[model samples]
Target: MKFEIIQPGSYAMIKATLTQGEAIKAESGAMVAMHPNLDVEGKVDGGMFGALKRAVLTGESLFFQTLKANRGAGEVFIAPAVPGDVTILELNGANHFFLQKQSFLASDDAIAIEAVSQGFFKGLLSGEGMFIQKATGKGSLAISSFGSIYKISLAPGQQYIVDNSHLVAWAGTVTYDVQKASSGWFSSVTSGEGLVCKVNGPGDVWFQSRNPGAFGSWIRQFIPSKG
Candidate 1:
């Protein structure tokens, strides 16, 4: 199977080419187009219990769309729910990644996505909730962001501060803690940063240029009140 990202920046989409019997799995409703020869099915990847956990804990769909070129070679087009950038990461079975909710787009059939707990405080303060999406196994995983995605490479023991809302995904080797953006809560709120993650690495972290939360707030200002 081969994956190509089209329209790289905003409004990005993925075009995946698969050989006979090869398959790819994507987030529900991600399919934009596909060849007639390809077959698509909805599957509860890790079974009913796992699906329920993913849905209840992480806010992901209960089922995934599995597309296969069973009859012959074919291509499928997949896109994210919102306008943004898309990126692909190749996993070799030796590493895994943790993704923010709704960041997952698609991945090879071999990749496995699950909802993993990131602890109560970390999840609550990080703005990613208590359960985060974890991708594992060997395959290509596609992730989407609300805006352009930026990669930050951190050396061992190096630390960086990131606004909680800007996080996309991070390598398994990276660790982070939720903290106030400034020394005091009032200052933090006044600074417009509020909570931030102090990420420590020996790994890479991906962040979106735009914050969906901030964008939603901006949009709300223009919406007329019902009263």
Candidate 2:
């Protein structure tokens, strides 16, 4: 698949062209436009139960739509529901990623999507929730982010702290933990900063320039609550 990221930052979209017999699987309803001759089929991504677990745990679509250029060649336009940026990454053998829930937009059929349990403390306090999305295998994966995406390639024993709201994904090759943003409880409360993620690596970490949760909080004040 060939891809071009249009509208690079906020309100981003992807324009992809596929060769004959090539296929891409995307979150259901991710298609904004496509060629008339393309074959688009909706099917359970992993398996019926696997799809259910991913939906219930990670908030991803239960079914994925496979787009194929069966007739000859085709093109598709894809965009996430959020007004954010999108990135297409190529995965190598067994190169897995621990992605924020619902960050995945599309990928080649070679990718395997699963729900990963983040455990109790990290799950509840971290912005990523208890169960997160994991993508494995070798293929091209498209990920969407709240704003611009930033990357940090870590050296051995390099550690970085990030506000959970700003994180998009990290290599499974890194070791990480989620904890309070401040050293003390009082500071954590007064700072208005919530839990954070600490990643130690020889791999890479990706972050978003904006925080959707913080943006929501600001917008929520103006939104009238239900009676």
Tell me, by lDDT, which candidate is best: 1
Residue 96 deviation, candidate 2, in Å?
Answer: 1.3
Candidate 2, 105-163: lDDT as tens digits: 88888799899998898887678778988889987888999888888999989999988
Work out the TM-score per prediction: 0.97, 0.95
Against the reference, the lDDT scores of all candidates come to 0.93, 0.86
Best by TM-score: 1
lDDT of 1 at 96: 94
Which residue pairs of candidate 2 clash?
none
| Model 1 TM-score, 2 decimals | 0.97
Per-candidate alpha-carbon RMSD to the true structure: 1.0, 1.4
Number of clashes found in candidate 1:
0
The lDDT, on a scale of 0 to 1, for candidate 1 is 0.93
